[model samples]
Target: MIPPATAPLFLEQAGWPHAAIVPLAGDASFRRYFRVIEGGRRAVLMDAPPPTEDPRPFIAIAEHLCQQGFAAPAILARDLNEGLVLIEDFGDLRLKEYLEDQPGEELAVYARAIDLLADLHQRPVADVPPYDRAVYLREAGLLTEWYAPATGLVVDAPAYVAAWEAVLPLVEQGSAPVVTVLRDYHAENIMLIDRPEAKGFNAHGLGLLDFQDALAGHPAYDLVSLLQDARRDVPAETEAAMLAHYKAVATPGADFDAAYAILGAQRNAKIIGIFTRLWKRDGKARYLSYMPRMWGLLERDLAHPALAPVADWFAANIPADKRHDALVAFAPE
Candidate 1:
């Protein structure tokens, strides 16, 4: 990471008269963000590590999405040489924080978020690459390599792999129209910006972020991202209602319930592995604490008769007793 003073200096050298660089919270990526408020206007400053974290692809994708009439931050300045970019600032309140304070209107806010997702999924991006089988398998492998070791369990490798592999058929069968999905369109990535002119669901405009991994894939995948959140508890009834709301606007042939079940299964499977890997490789146990909640999500989805076979398979193999032990082993102290 570059020093704060050097970041502004680099911006100055790049011909921006001056910049006010204040760091923004980032997750487990090499990317860092700063809100640059200068001339009474706000812009986000991205400091991406070029050697390990390339920004070009993300930048290009954001621009293409903007052209397609989506809410992507406009690029104000770029220093490709330094892997730094200046973009329009969306504001401070993330959807997660916003929802925490707006308990009375939580479902309503999620309704709008889902509306944005519907628009996102409706856009065609034929040229964008799809997340094929190799990627799916690779992600699953992370759990085996990282989480299993962290939990001190000689994870049944074949069982773990098969656990996720078991769902692939369902994944393919449940595919929706392929579109550019903001792969991580969760509450944490959204910003609540003030826009009075925007009406109806647009009462408070949404700011999108961490969309660099956007890919052409299943439409309902992101819906699952928001609805079946690993971090928070979303009610089953609320989940059903949100599914219905999305279905009301989705295209013909898109089976909202089936897609939701498959996506819920798919995402939870990936997260199980992610939480495991986070503990083992990064020595971060905080994520491990969320596994039970995630397991609960998988349990909920498996209740769908369509997913019963996979559910039964997991229960028969993983066993609730072993799962309880696994959770107790690595969860944060």
Candidate 2:
């Protein structure tokens, strides 16, 4: 992961020319990251090339989150034309890995995240794209478009759309007074900071990342993302406890429960397809390992009465036996 040729000049202009740029781990995007060390301090340099990705949304949302007093990374420098940005470093303690080492802290750490969402919902909605019905349907369509065909199944596309058509109105109705929905809010995107001196700076003691895809949508969306995370196993008891915690603290609209179930199913379906696409198209086989978890979570969500139609659609199109990777991963590509 070599930094771009102009990277040195950019760092130099940002006053870190001689800084040692150490490559950092990357995510499921065209973006790459580096830790620029200078003056005994560190900053993250994001290289998000254009046409496939945009750095503007990230910059805008980051500034907004900072203004609202959340722990989003502080933007230190930017070169939008080159799709590069320098931001404050939030160490290597990702919430997922941290919780893996300290399983006892899962409940408490998730409580802080839920509490942060409650506080965020209370603030004004940011200027962002709407997570509208069309967007929801398009996201869910990834399953039919990518996963189903890859699995050698002829899933009924029309039936799939019809199922969502019946359930999404409930989502639209419940998502009143829209707020910022951090579309990727999960254990992986959060960093646990040890800010002993400035703990008050982030009351939750969590650092947020990869939130450029924020949307104005139902508050329950992010909760589902965190609780039903495909990357890690959030224990069933912990999930139940966190749901109760969020409801008690947020006291959202009456339809929160229904929306949570609906969105959870939708999110899991999208993730399943995305993981398949990663393997089939991007040649990223590692994502395939997450499919089983996504399927398990989707099945759990489908148990909700609110998602009856979508559940029926899945049951009819993709049998329980074919709801996983076995049929697809080995299928003729």
Which candidate should be chosen as best, given TM-score against the real structure? 2
Which runs in model 1 stand beyond 4 Å of their true positions? 1-6, 13-15, 159-166, 173-175, 196-204, 252-255, 321-333
> Would you estimate the TM-scores of all the predictions?
0.86, 0.96
Best by lDDT: 2
Least accurate 10 contiguous residues by lDDT in model 1: 196-205
Candidate-wise lDDT, in order: 0.70, 0.88
All-Cα superposition RMSD per candidate: 3.2, 2.1
Q: How well does model 1 score by local distance difference test?
A: 0.70
Error of 1 at 183 (Å): 1.3
List the pairs of residues colliding in candidate 2. none
The residue-by-residue lDDT of candidate 2 on 191-211, one tens digit each, is 888687432257888889999
Residue 242 miss distance in model 1 (angstroms): 0.9
Model 2 lDDT vs. the true structure? 0.88
Clashes of 2: 0
Off by over 4 Å in 2: 174-176, 196-200, 327-333
Q: How many angstroms is residue 136 displaced in model 2 relative to the true structure, after the best TM-score fit? A: 0.3
